[model samples]
Target: MAFCTSTDINCEPCLYNSISVPGKGWCLSCEEGLCQSCVDSHKRRLATKNHKIIEKCHHVASIRHLMSQTCKNHNTILDRYCPFHDDPVCSLCILEKHTNCKGILSLDNVAKNVASSSSLFSLQQNIANLVKNLSQLNKVRTRSSKQLQSDKIVKYTSVRAMRKRLDKHLDTLEEKLLQELSSKAGTCETEINNSLSEIESKTKAAYAVQSNITLLKTMATDVQLFLAIRDIDTSVTTETNWLREFANQHNTDELNLDLNTKPMEDLLRTKSLGSVRIDRIPNHVPINHLNMKEAQIPREAMCNGIDQIQLYQKIHIQYHNEKLVEILFGCIISSNGDIILADGPSKKFTVFNEGGNHIKDIHLPGTPSDLTEISQGRIAVTYGNSKKMEIAEIKDYHYKTVISVRTVASCWGISCDNGQMAVKLLTERINLYDTNGLRIQQIKVEESCPHYINDITIAHRHIYYSYPYQNSVFCLGLDGTLIWKYESDFLQHPRGITTDGYGNVYVVGRHSKNLIVISKDGQNGRELLKCNITPWSVHFDKHYNKLLVRDSEGATVYKVAFRL
Candidate 1:
């Protein structure tokens, strides 16, 4: 019945010849239906031999009608799938829009066994829960309706029995009380009926989706199932969120009528028999929500690039003495998510937990310029002008120095990865050191450096550093080969620098008062965060997907979301 009025037309004719024979199979790439004779010839042809075909009996024509097989922009058959964009495209679309997209796979491969995937399983569970919730809510309404009816009759009986003991004046009061009871009961009934109508409508929709899922599992092709599931999941999520809000606002609680017969007990006090009033008893029906992890599944891995960031927590650094000035410099997030900041002017290392609560402060013999995590629960700090780097184990309020490495020039920026350390000097060179404090190699930046390098980070075999005076960031290989240099007007006076391990660099700009993220190749960059004050340092914890930034007043943490 798709795009056709007659049965002969319903089954698209074989594309190989002019004959109007009913098609027995559908070719995905060709986007055409074929007869049995053409199906055999299609598989035998050299160009179409490996083409994926679905049986016409599987109702694939309906799939094509529901989800267009052709790209609307290019007006051509969609044969390729781009995981980067999460879109199906034609050859023309690839040439026009997806030329640089990575991981572009054939549609057939992406749809392979999609019916048996976790996405389908989650969809099934979500719809089933929706039906259950609607049924339970309906049950509550039915119980409340029966209780209301029973309570109304009892109140009516009490009013009439009380009127029997009084005079003719009481008869008028009885009539008035009965009318009030009926009116109140009618209103309750109307509300219940309206609620039932809503419940029934939602239930019918849930059942329709459940039935379609069953059909998909049995009669639909894998590609058809894949496309249908995405749309179905979106609909289910909308319905689920609406139902949750509705349940919170409108619960069918039990209502009862109370006959206030105080006047009836004291005949001399008043002429009225009684007054009818309503009493409410709280009732609740639960809705079990499905786990939404499947709905949030990403198309690509997170190591590709950062999509955005959200403020997670804020920490206020405390200064014990008002006279001691706090000049925050180095920042790092331990493996367990503890934030450590070095205050050079104060000559102390302040620590905080993931919840932004202060843990402790460790005083140092010399002023620390920067710090880096050497291993789990262990950290190394660089002292500016002291020409020394101290390795220590820190946890909460406990701290102990293990060893100190002496540098030739004043030590400034420091980073450690896999037992190797890269320490930047106040001069024009970076000294590499091992765990035993022995110098392994040195890199000279006299030609490219601009006065001084403020901070450095090493990740994935590349050294990343920032130059605030020049408003630039640089990446270098192990052999001191300059890979790429990134400069942007938005990143003026860059200070702290780090990487996401995927090659994207994160740096803080002091004068610009913002954070900038540069792409792996350094050809593209964007401002990520606009700070209220000058930010002095930044550190990224890849294991926990957390970012730490040290500013003039205090530090802050962010939960990062990444996409390729």
Candidate 2:
């Protein structure tokens, strides 16, 4: 839980393990190993590019030995050593201690052959084993602590709940006993839960040992590993002892409710004739935890800023006196900042340069309802009435279709993240598709939205869909669990939704006629800009901090700039 610096974690892989290649430098803020490949990527991100990185030299590995020079006992020079006890001693200890021990030697002599020692590998394995054990124990203790808090809250709530029930059951003896039973058992539960707090002290010790050993294994060379192994083992052993003490002291007590008859000697007492007395039986059972959260999530490889983006750029397909009723239903900006759009009335997909200049317009087979940037400059567009979709690309200023497929039903709204795409159909169901354009799964929009699923977008590995009538946006995980829905202050008729590279979502509110920026976690929302007319679409250029918004009344695109 303690944040370690870049020197603690191994530099990120430069394609392969950095251990095999020399580190170009270290990103101190990210605590990541760096290579030339990520240099531009890191500098592009709004949150991370400003991070300070130190370029490392070839001799950096040699300096790993410096990690072992500190003496734990004296915080001084570790010069003397005792072979019998296998412990390092400082100069103050050479005169005052280890004088009577036989076969005493210098600290360096004991460590000279450590890299070649048979125990080096064994010690490394031991350290790894301890890491696994301590990590699991730490997680279990942490969960237990949270569960304990929940149970405490439940107990407090039950007391008030039982008090009300007692009033209702005043005439019934059985109900009176039930209320007394809960009250007595709640007290016993608190004591047992309070006692479990002792595990925290031990878990922290194990965590410290695991961190130190893991850091040594990663940042230290083989010889450094050998020299630090004994001291690390001592610290690990102390943590192990703490864990043992926790196991010995911690217990899960079971509450028992029994009927206790009131004494006949107290005839004037108004209390219930029979009462429930609670007792606890301490059970020495410990909890074992399991099930990993998930494998991992990959993020955007590069970051970009939008300082160069200009305003008042528009893309309109007008053939003198032709009425283009529904123009831009949805739009997307590719990772390279090229713009893509679903031109509904024109029945085509439009591509624009990062500067908003019209490039190539690839006419679709039918009315293109919604568009999502698939990858790079490639895009997937859905047909409103054709019940079909196709993957297209804009390369070298030319429009080319990659593939076309007919779906079971017409899907209007589409979005893609990672390799997955979600298509929002007219029936208010989202069809999930893999990279091959094959429908993998379908998710239903069950939230209370009086309107249609206007636009679907994916970000942070989750799906975000807008409903103008609901005046809100709902965020759901890829598995279809609704994480949170925002319908608060800044939102009016939130329509199109898209996430920036940093996980912040930008949405257009048709009713409020403003651009809303909701945080990635869905905890807050703020109106970033107010449009003169209701904005039909809001899309973020993945390569830059620029946001592209098109008003409903015109073909004009508003290029706005803001920090993540």
Candidate 3:
């Protein structure tokens, strides 16, 4: 080990390099020269108390490079390299984020000859390219701003011209319509109040019974089951009868929104002067890509024609408790590397540890389609052709549904962000709903693949959807406007889609029998891997870069070592 710049000749500096006078000791674990004061302070902190330390020697063999950098998240030394992300991380980060990432490199090997590597030269060239592109974009944005001001004036002039041309009889029509609107609003309020009261009472009773019955089952005792059996039977029977009655009597969806001059309603509203719908102006603004850096793998590997996950481990989860069944559609990995898979044939969610050892399995009410993590031990799962989405909480290897909401039709892929959910309906539209199951917006695709959406993923303002039947993928804005559409020869039956932190999209192609990576702009694509088994569902942990893929053929889930 080489001496650090912090090491002094007269008196060993403190653990922190800034101290002028020192003379206490050295932390062998931290590999830094420490003073008596720092040594005392170090032991006082809970995280560093047990670290190895020794008296300072003439030649302090402390870490010179490692101490210079730290993990941004944990605020500790960056000592580990996450090969999946191609970034240095701390030990704390390894468990918090990279537990599912299989192959991790040490920082020591990554730093050796890094200065001479072409990566540094490429980075310099990128910076130069970014500067040039950004300068041009700034000019374009300035021009657009000026054009916007001019357009505003022109639009205002047109509005005034049209208003002057309108007839004076409009006031009588407006007054009559306002009265009818107010009357309708009053009636709607009363209907909403009645529904709310009934819903609240029934929801409370059903939840109470569900909790009691689930608790009874968990207790696994004859006495508890016997005690709750009568109440459980009564509650279940009452709720079943109430559901049938409510379905017949409910006036929930009778009213329809319209944009016609009169009461004439058209589901597809187009070519109207006043259209109330969600849309976006085409994004023609040029963005500087080089400065907006994405996660970078060893471009050398990519350039050298190494286009695969490199090392992948598969866990064939066919049989559970001596019964074999095929998995449904999805897979998710917890922060601790616990694999939870939804099996359609068994109607169960099976779990396994990082080492592929069987854990506990949770039963589902129906066939599961897709699942997304809600919290550390909770997830939201969708049931295919059932039109039901259930939120489940996992505790001690047991799972129970806490909430369930019905979508408009058969729900397929489900992803949630900002407490709002984007659910793909069987009718080839994505419905945005609030936490309380209120539909906020419906995303209808008119450009392409207007048939069926296999999977959808959300990241901030961007929504990604895969068109399996059409062999295409589309990136859209939150307002449901297409940002860009990608159709590739490499993509055949794109079943699952996910995005990395770099805005790059990854899609699994069932027909192509490969995992494909599409650039952030949807302009370029390359095969990530040629699969042994056809892949259906795919998910990427952006924080960890670990890829979880489900094979459509069987109960096998492949944990691929995904790199940037």
Candidate 4:
């Protein structure tokens, strides 16, 4: 649609001529413009007779931008397009470089409908989405930068405030210690001063007694002298005893203050008041970027029913030389595409890789009835005959119990999503717990009282379960409101249930020996596959779009595709 205004719009003259002429047609194969006489002569030649030449002015205008449309090696116009190599080639170029390429067509035909193709539109939309995502991320990063600046100031102020508080606390301790030292020193000084005053009074009384005794010896009779002497002796004896007791109890030892410096030394050894750690949290900004697989699907196909099931791998779960068992109660796929099966008879979990090779076997404390992965390498398991569920961590091909949740009745099936876990109990109740195994609530099922719900799964804010005796599948909201109950003859005694990205429910019928996929509305059901072995459990790995159907002895993985 673009008009030609460049200098190349004029006619390319004959190869041997020096004159230019107005173009009457464009030779796509020759990669040159043709005047009226040149157009007649071009079609007369045998080599150029079959070449595509556009005679319209608008068509020439559109193709004027297809500059330098010639093979570099052959110096020939690139007229043919090799579909296999995805390149335009001349006759000589195709013979040399793309001889084996198939579906080679004329370049003009190949590019005629490109502008109206869905691929072009999709590419444009992808570019737009990319720009929008970049803008969002840029805004988030800019805001985060500003937040970092503000947080830096706030953190600095907080640190300074803590230092000041520490200084004040130390000052208080120092003041209390100094005050105690001063009080003790003052008491010592007062005691010494009181002792000095008492000594001085005693000395003065002794001098008075000596003067009286001297006067009596010179001028008084024997009776007066004797009475005075006896009174002085009594006073002297009491003073001597008091002085002896004081000397025994007290000594002039040095009043040195010894401070216990251990606490101060420990304080000085501290490196910092506290640590400042930077933790990388999940990004709050949603970057809606589609990967290759998601981007290739047409928008309308996203909500369509599953088109077909392609078998990916078939795995025989029995351990080497082990006798056949009848109780493989639970099956799940780890994040690494490793299949983990809970063998009730063996009281252990068996692991196998995507290639159907046996990896390892992990022993469980109790018989596991159902298991679900709560996070990467972590699973919550419900025991069939026990009143507790064990949370275990899978590491280095081994598993260890992390925690346990106690139930009022025996635990059966378990499913976990987001941070919440829904565990099916032997009674008609589902015990809800957090990831840490703390029971938060109990959802009582009034529909299946005598026969409890067999398997349970939670997805997309909805709780799904199977009632084997009732021969039905029930979907309920998180608050236990019934959404739909699916009853079908094909789903006889459904034991295990799971969901896919399209919200389609996949369940296994133990008695029917089939795997059936129900619609999201629970109004329709289709048996995806039937097996010779009775299917005990079913699990769908949404990450890889693979289906896992398991029995006591074997399991199969299928790659699922959806169609509009």
Tens-digit lDDT string for candidate 4 (1-564): 112334344467664487677787877556578888889989999988997676653344432433345466887766776544435678998778888765577766544433332323343343344344434444443444454445545655554454455555455444444455445445544544555455455545544444444443443323223222333444444544454454344422222333332233454455333334332233444333222222122334445554433233445554421442444387888888899877776778888898888888898787788999999988899887778898889888777989977788888888988788998888878888999999888887877754444788988888899888978999988888899999998778888899986688988888888888888888778888887877777888877677788775677776665322
If both were scored by TM-score, which would come out higher, candidate 1 or candidate 2? 1
Residue lDDT tens for model 1, 430-452:
88988767889999875445355
Q: Per-candidate RMSD vs. true structure?
A: 17.6, 23.9, 22.0, 36.7
Query: Lowest-scoring 10 consecutive residues by lDDT in candidate 2?
Result: 291-300
Candidate 3 per-residue lDDT, tens place, 1-564, comes to 011334452224432455576555656455566767777888898999997555543333322222235455877866677755645778999998889976687665554433332343344343333334333433433443454445444544543454354455344444444444445444544554565455555555544444443433333222223222322343344444454455345323232222223222321242223321111233233322222122233344333332434535455554332232222377777756787777776788788875667888788788888888766777788897888898888888777888888877788888767677787777757888765566799998664343554688887678888887768898889889889988988789888788665566778898898988777777778887788777777776654445677665433444334343
> Could you tell me which 10 consecutive residues in candidate 3 have the lowest summed lDDT?
286-295
Please identify which of the two predictions, 1 or 3, would achieve the higher lDDT against the true structure.
1
Question: What TM value does model 2 have?
Answer: 0.43
- Cα error, residue 332 of model 4, in Å, equals 1.0
Q: Write the per-residue lDDT of candidate 2 for residues 1-564, one digit (tens) a residue.
A: 222323332446554543544457655444446666566678888988787665652333333433455566776766656543445677767667767765556655555545544344444454455545545555554454465456546644544454454444344644565566667656655654454454455456445555555655555544345456655555555545555455465434344555555444542344564665555444443333211111101111112222211232334422211333344377766777567666677766676776557778766667777787777667788876688888887677555778887776666778887789888776757789986788898887786442354688877789988877768888988888889988875677677788876566778887788877777778777766767766777776654345677665433444332211
Quote the positional error of residue 444 for candidate 3 in Å.
1.9
- Mark the regions of model 2 whose C-alpha exceeds 4 Å error after superposition: 1-328, 395-400, 448-453, 553-564
Using alpha carbons, what is the TM-score of model 1?
0.48
